[model samples]
Target: QSNIIKAEFAEIGERYNDKRRSEIIPISGDLSIEDIIADEEMVVTITHNGYIKRLPTSTWKTQRRGGRGMKGAHTKDDDFIEHLFIASTHDKMLFFTDRGKCYWMKVHEIPPGLRTSQGRAIVNLIGCEAGEKVKAFVSVKEFNETDYIVMATRKGVIKRTALSMYSRPRKGGIYAIEIREDDELIQAKVSHGDQDIILATYRGKSIRFNENDVRSTGRKTMGVRGIRLGTKDDYVIGMLIVKREGSVMVVTNKGYGKRSDLSAYRTQKRGGKGVITIKTTDKVGNLVGIMEAIDDDDLMLITDRGIMIRQAVEKIRTIGRNTQGVRLAKLDDKTYITSATRVLKDEEENEEEEAAETEEE
Candidate 1:
């Protein structure tokens, strides 16, 4: 039996003695990943109920953002797209939770499906701790110190940290910030550290301050206050970094909104009581959202009732600081504006002109 085993081994060894070689043979695992996985462009849609899905990018090529996006998701009536972003299948998506921890996943890990299909729950794709929910996320292709991440809390705390710090995260998730028990991270933005930071509160108050006011800090520290809340329930509802000059539009729960010039909001010391950015009353409800807008920028406002309305900023009627300008959306009872964002900084006029040209043709 031993002699038979040794003879078998010798036969195997002789077969590979550089005598068996083929010029056309290929190396193992050398196949192109693009071929194995289609590298086509994808459209990623995230709904308010923590659902995320991806469709082919061509699905939205001709459809402008405010022009009634092709039913991105058929979620519960209560759900809507709170955060929407674009990334290639090879990009990395970083999910920052309310608990101040972040989870990272490749864009392709998100399953691709029909535009109307309800997406997989975020919690099922990424591991989130109990009671933790995704508040904001950034799709990053490269992490560099040249870029900075500006984070704002619901309690008005603001922090800026280097983008390079998040280049490598642990599999179990790492702390993005040290948040208080009562405060949750509400906004996260990528900036170059020189843009102006705007914080709008729920009670129609807003403050614009230099981004340098808050010193860049490490990941484990609590941020400095950006806006001082007069009441316990008064928290920040909107935050954004602007590089260009524009008005800050404030939208209320009753769909009342107005655009006030940036010149109207004088830069003040951080943590001070903000000036009255708009009027709020028992009739008009508290402010629900805010955005930096130009005269020609097209803004999209979505309500909790699943209604999306788009209008040019010029049509919003720029007004003084202390007035509720006009009704942006006529809403039913109990329905309020959930989120507002600029669909395009400038392009509505161009799109309209092109449409008119086509009509003439």
Candidate 2:
């Protein structure tokens, strides 16, 4: 009655005052795509053949060190696990391909799967070309203009571009780096434009160079050589953007791994043969992967036979870069470590869960 005008009181008779047919409800505001999707922790896994999927983080239970890990995926004879990382469903995922192109999508856009499901082909999701292979997957919360995208190729080429340059991506992907014939992009990292970039080779050689050493280039240009390969067979295996505090963790094919101090790798000129990272011999084998890891991080090691073991980084021995690392995973002769990644400590996840519960309340 208060909302009605005095002049309209006569028009509002018994029929007008009848019971309302609909209820008036209120909403906070318009909802966005992200607002509808649940922001939960997800485990993202990519196979060597470019099959990708995301499963709930609780799919795998924590196991003690040296416990036989469960089979992570069912792959064909030639295909195997290539990459694994944990991220939130709301996070942005950057997919860098060996063909020097980059694609962007939200983590929730990836096909969801169960523990034993073979994932959808990455090519089908990102519209990759017939022969293009996704070589690296980076999860970022936000694309800050001040940050930079650092990319490395198997032939030791490295490029740095402003992160804002890649803020807008196309469905078919855009050129990230110009690769010469026979050279392919190995991996990419998002840096703050002043951190150190480490390029690790399969032959146990690594070169640490500041991100500033390579001049920032446009998206479609070829980068300068960041390291010199000893031979054609000794290509770059992994790249790491490191800070001053954490150690450079390197894992070998034979399940041997170690964490070397960041101080051991002095910043060197780009294009020089790097210092010895690990002693690659008949026993320890060649390097499989390397990462910037801290004591609180959990290391996820995957073998070529689809076996995955999550070991605490602190359990791995910290030694000089020139010596062979201690045994991180016991492997049979037929199985070898293919790739490794880090899972942050549970404190962060616990905090996120609590925050979500609060929001729900």
Candidate 3:
């Protein structure tokens, strides 16, 4: 009886058509594993301690220039949102770290939450070293060789690499720029190679040079000096790359900020003693950041105390290089503006007719 059962099983196994059946597959592989959250634009925020989240474009009602914005984040006294950007959920965000490595992710990958709620840790989403901190990140639809990412360091070093070099990123990330032990990567801006670069120093000094001055270099190499620091206390704080339009904005920690005409900061050779970009005074405090923006752009100011204020850049008076800037944000004894970024004009205008209808519903 045992021999007969074994023979029957063997005959059944041999008769099965395993080869042809295994080759059959579905007609289409187009089913999406990720949700479609790209219908609306989002405002993403990254705190100093690496907490990040995204909110809808309609999070804060638009405000006029100089009108202190609504409190946008509830952060610890020591932590504040250091970076904020306007991007579509479908766009890819290339997170660049201080160690010269980068991690690529989509805006949708960042879980959506309220502005007051601290979101997930960015380091977890994009694997990074223990001590590595994000220095700069940019959003792009697709990497193209026509555009370049110009990076600057705390020691006044600058490097430019083609965007195509970062098209393919890894789980562990790859080299974006080389840095010495004593220096640190500070700022990054995307622009055409023909644009101009404005490097602002801590002590209210800045230099404008043609982007062509710094030739494109490899991803693993260090760059040449973009400015000559006037004092040991002064380090490069802001690096703005812009074409012929827009004004250069200088903001101080004490809440003083002003917009200066780009033409006022005449183009100079790289690595020179930059002219006075802002007059630092006891009341005005130290220069904290600089931005390339126009009157139409909306300014988002983040205080070290975690307070965020959104105002129009047009409200801030455009002054000269030697003048102390006007009050861009009102500050208290222990609070002051730390970092600031701009939202484009079109992105801020969310088709009022549609937004009003949504809110009414």
Candidate 4:
């Protein structure tokens, strides 16, 4: 054995003297020479107690294998235990020790337990990538209050839900319930008291006008007195005249008992009492009275301020004939005019003219 060792050592030295040209060789032995010589890259091995020992030219490898008598078992400085246990990502690793206490470690923390199948699994799972899918089947030796299984992604954050912990498969994706945009409801209000009364030419037969239906342009007051309906007063009373061609007619009360007749005109009477015709144009007497000398359409309300509020011609009071009233008419220029007089029944003539015009058109 001594001669064999000497011869082997000589051969090893000759083969490895030139570091660049040296070849690695494995050998088994338990022999001591003053200084064992071999190729720098050579590896020597010895077998004993079912364990294999390897010797290399590097001191780092020797230390890693637990230098000298520390063979087979890792030394206190050996990091294999820690490297085998620590997670590689931003997650925690959990291990159940034989003592029943749970152990936890962060990705870079040193591991404390002997490497086992369960320990390996825990380490791998903790270092998984973000959004990585995982399925786990684990058994606990004993219940530990502090031992909580945190289901986290490789990112180390667990999704918060109403139930158990989970992680989304992908980041920045739409949620189960998407957020909605803001919406609102709008409404508009119109005050009848503020709207101005414009002469509107409507085609219809005998529409009735009521005080309630007629909106007041003038400020609301207890009663109609010295009031005007339309433009400023510039005409005489009892004379049904259209101030302007298209403008509404203005009827002024000249004196007492001088009533304007709008019988030829159409009119609508809304709310109020009495069938008084051409009554005195007293400032306080009657602002709106039923016509007695003309048809209902031929009546209008003569304001104390001399502006005539023309009743629409399409509206006719249901009251009898010979009633004094006014009827509203739309001229070719779309002007509203009120004609006051005794009741006139000329529907047939008007219809004939309408038909002729239609035929011509």
Which regions in candidate 4 have their CA more than 4 angstroms from the true location? 1-288, 293-297, 311-314, 317-361
Q: Residue 336 CA error for candidate 4 (Å)? A: 19
User: TM-scores of all models?
Assistant: 0.77, 0.71, 0.71, 0.13
Evaluated with TM-score, which candidate comes out highest?
1
Error of 4 at 173 (Å): 99
* Comparing 2 and 4 on TM-score, the stronger one: 2
On lDDT, the stronger of 1 and 3 is 3
lDDT of candidate 1 over 1-361, digit per residue (tens): 9999999999988886775465676678766554467666677878767888887877765855445334556778656655556788877788988888878887888988787788889887898888888888888877877888889999999998988898887887888899999889987888887778889999888888988898999888898989999888799998978777878788888888888887888888789988998889977788988888787677778787678877777777888988876888888888888877776533455656667888999
In terms of lDDT, model 4 sits at 0.26
Q: After TM-score superposition, what is the CA distance of residue 103 in candidate 3 from its true location, in Å? A: 1.6
Off by over 4 Å in 3: 1-91, 112-119, 306-311, 329-336, 343-361
Ranking by lDDT: 2, 3, 1, 4
List model 4 lDDT by residue over 282-337, tens digit each.
Answer: 33122212123322233343332334443333344333222323333223332222
TM-score of 2: 0.71
lDDT per residue for candidate 3 within 1-361, as digits (tens), equals: 9999999999999998376645666656565534444356899988767788999989889886434456667877656666677888777888788777778888888888886887888888887889998887888877887899899998899898888888877778888888898888887768876988889988899998998899888788998899999888889987888764888888898988898888898999999998999999999988888888887777877887778777778878888889998988778888988877775443424355346677899
Q: Which stretches of candidate 2 lie over 4 Å from their true place?
A: 1-91, 107-121, 140-143, 344-361
Clashes of each: 0, 0, 0, 43
Looking at model 4, report the run of 10 residues with the lowest lDDT sum: 183-192
**Which model is ahead, 1 or 2, in terms of TM-score?**
1
Residue 173 displacement (Å), model 3: 1.3
